[model samples]
Target: MSVLLNLREAHPALHTHPTPVLPPWPRVVVLPANRSPYGLDLPLDGTATVAVRPYVTAHEQRERRRELALATLGLDTPGPYWIHGLEVA
Candidate 1:
């Protein structure tokens, strides 16, 4: 069985919601564990999972443009996006 299958069978409550519009500023995302290539030693402990699809906001787009402009001028100081873990669930 696939990870998605295991997730659904073991956790029927796991449902996907429509992706919502993100804020103009950068937000954080907590990535779930890998659930691919079935038959791994992974286990789902009765927890539900959610997937999110994020799009670039106008402000973010402008920021990216600014960053690119700075990079062209050799003054780029871009920050990294962090992916947190879901331990509480």
Candidate 2:
């Protein structure tokens, strides 16, 4: 087990189940659209996982994520959106 995982097991008061890190491959579908969203078929094998909650205390660490997320064209934030998903084999 990783040291972080061990730490979580040791301190229930300070830690919790982390997020599942999805395998970088086996794509997870993200529906990004305003006019009738479409489904994306991910290639996931369904075994990979990521942390459930944050393991870090700094917000700066996540800044890169936000920036990368906004890199796509024609994407604007702070908008009305609805999302629902289903998974199948």
Candidate 3:
């Protein structure tokens, strides 16, 4: 069986969340384990899994700022505007 199948059988709680909609090939940033402020306790083999929480929070902040800027310019920001440029996936 595949890893997903194993995970599904071993941990049901992991499947509680809805499937996240992501691009076919998403960008990946690999941070060196020594440089990472997290995952220090884990036995990392030179790389660390970066947290998405910071990136998500930053994206939200950027969106709010864009809205404010648009509002100041007497224009309304669209409800679901596609984010362009580096989105730090």
Candidate 4:
């Protein structure tokens, strides 16, 4: 039960502009359970299959979390998280 930012919509300019491509691994950002962006209180209580490959680095993880927190306007809090590349299976 987690929320994920729709990256494509979040940064349309970056997504559509000509920039060096980044790997999908770094694009995944999962919000903690019971948390959702401001205004859109979407319920997340359904089961969904997912596969994850853990990828972590203390510095990088912290930075990523911080960035997400700012982007979400504090709706997302920076906290402990093991970065992972996830795929819906």
Please list the Cα RMSD from the true structure of every candidate, rounded to 1 decimal place.
34.7, 35.3, 30.9, 38.0
lDDT winner = 3
Candidate 3: clashing pairs of residues: none
In order of listing, the candidates' clash counts read: 0, 14, 0, 0
TM-score, cand. 2: 0.17
For residues 15-45, what per-residue lDDT tens digits would candidate 1 score against the true structure? 8676799769766888998777777677755
Candidates 1 and 4 compared by lDDT, better number: 1
lDDT of 3 by residue, 1-89 (tens): 59979889999887697878976886698876565467466586645566567889999988878876776797875465534453322
Model 4 worst lDDT run, 10 consecutive residues: 80-89
Alpha carbon lDDT at 23, candidate 3: 69
Question: Model 1: what TM-score?
Answer: 0.26
TM-score of each: 0.26, 0.17, 0.30, 0.21
- Rank the candidate models, highest lDDT first: 3, 1, 4, 2
Error of 2 at 45 (Å): 46
- Model 1 spans > 4 angstroms off: 1-56, 81-89
Q: Rate the local accuracy (lDDT) of all candidates.
A: 0.63, 0.55, 0.70, 0.58
> Per-residue alpha-carbon lDDT of model 4 for 38-76, expressed as tens digits?
656765544664544455466777787776666568454
Please write out the lDDT profile of model 2 over residues 25-79, one tens digit for every residue: 8768898665524544555565686544464635644653564466455454554
Q: After superposition, how far is residue 33 of candidate 1 from its true place, in Å?
A: 49
